[model samples]
Target: MDPTAVGRSGAVILRPMRVDDVAEAERLSALAFAVLEGNSDLTRPPERAAAWQVRTAHLVSRDGAGCWVADADGTMVGFATSLRREGLWILATYAVHPSWQARGIGRALLDAAAHHGRGALRRMVGATTDPKALRRYRSAGLDLHPTMVLEGTVGATAMELPLHVRDGRPSDHEWMDSLDRGLRGAGRGEDHTLLSALHPLRVIDRPHRRGYAYLAPDSTVELLAASDRRTATDLLTDALSGAVGADVRQAHVTAANQWAIDVGMAAGLSLRAQGYLCLAGMKPPSPYLHHRALL
Candidate 1:
């Protein structure tokens, strides 16, 4: 077999990512993002590494074929992990070492990972502000909707949540999965276990009303899915009950989720355009907020 069956020189290769690659992939991913979002340099908290490893491991376990890694010698320099569910294909994570950017490695990994979505009718990914990544998604045939973020101190005013919304329990998993199917064209399934563990899930379930939101301790909406725009707004509003006067943030807002933007701004939070929500064969799901890695 040819050594460079994947690309470049024999020293560099693109191949199926192994489960063991998750550790290296997580490190490289963090370093790359730090560089991308640099205020001047890069740093890591050290303790947060294990959490990402668990998340990355789940992706590999569920869809190994949808994950790929770029290896130069024995080191993992780039990787992409994706998953296909109920006719929807989601790009979970895509990153390349900052030094390897613009070298065609990202394009290769994207093409490889996207193959897993071949028969899926819809595709989605939360993209960053990086120009090259945006171009790659555009070239792949996804329509781009600029992403917005609503962030600031939650005025004491916005913390009021309606009566129907309540703390989600373990029993709510099935219902949340149902909402996932209705809104995003798929069910999160086991992914829910991971998400709920990371951020406690908040829910609203009633006749004619059903929705879910994962709220971090800091009050950011990690993810939200709902039956209607109003339900979606309520769930988001509820996420901020404990964030009053603190510097809070809600991210991953797209034009598809204007209700969130409206509710957020009405609470005195500022809105700004950041990355994008790229889609193919679908429109942005309304009253929905997305998790960067999971969505």
Candidate 2:
């Protein structure tokens, strides 16, 4: 399928994203999110712009076939990246230049991503705090549900677990995939593989049960997937303990998953903000904690 099949409309063009578009995509993403914050209670860190750029580049490098860009004449106006793994397709990051909003560029870019993954996409998911953005996603066929962001300083804690913690290895992909599927109802093999290589994954090895959490280099708890609340708490406790030297540690939890939220609060984290997890074609699983952008 030619992602660029939808050609120029007046001066706008919808096309597949390229490796070179990452820098501009990062700029537009930062600008778009900053503007979005102005319309909602959401807050973004000053360093997120650079962080988003790096994440965007990684997503493009990992799944370029699922990324698309809307170009106005020759300048990029908008972009969207979707990560397809098994039955899931996540709209990982999406943004349009503030100057170019309301002109259908965003819609086109979104459509291109959906089209590119139509054959394999069983469910689609995304997150946003802005009502206008919610409307756009709803209009595109997703159902919105409440989610929250929890953040606070990470400190040493004395929570002991029955299982031992160890760094994840490539051989553990099968266990990771099985655990993720059991918890989230979908497998994120590709995402887990990429993240494991890019960041450190702290794993709990028990006799029959296993769990894992991704501790980013910056000490943020990027994601945690476990079979039960106790295992989840143990993983999070380990993550927060390791994050003792970092300025901040954060996690995005589904509102329905009060256990996970309580775990964060018990670990000395506070409610930072709230948002919605919009899903299309499936119900979201509970007890899941991941970055909002990756929802």
Q: Give me the runs in candidate 1 sitting further than 4 Å from their true place.
A: 1-10
Worst 10 residues of 1 by lDDT: 1-10
Candidate 2 structure quality by residue, lDDT tens digits, 14-86: 7778878887887777678878777452334646656666667777887787798888778988888987766
**lDDT per residue as tens, model 1, 164-282:** 88888889999888888877888888888888777778889989889999886578788999899989888887777667788887889888788988888867899998999999988
TM-scores vs. true structure, each candidate: 0.93, 0.85
List, in order, the clash count of every candidate structure: 0, 0
lDDT of each: 0.84, 0.71
Report RMSD for candidate 1.
Answer: 2.4
Best by TM-score: 1
The per-residue C-alpha lDDT of model 1 at residue 245 equals 82
Itemize residue pairs with steric clashes in candidate 2: none
Local distance difference test, candidate 1: 0.84
Which portions of model 2 show Cα errors greater than 4 Å? Answer: 1-6, 38-55, 119-121, 155-163, 245-247, 292-294
- Give the top-scoring candidate (lDDT): 1
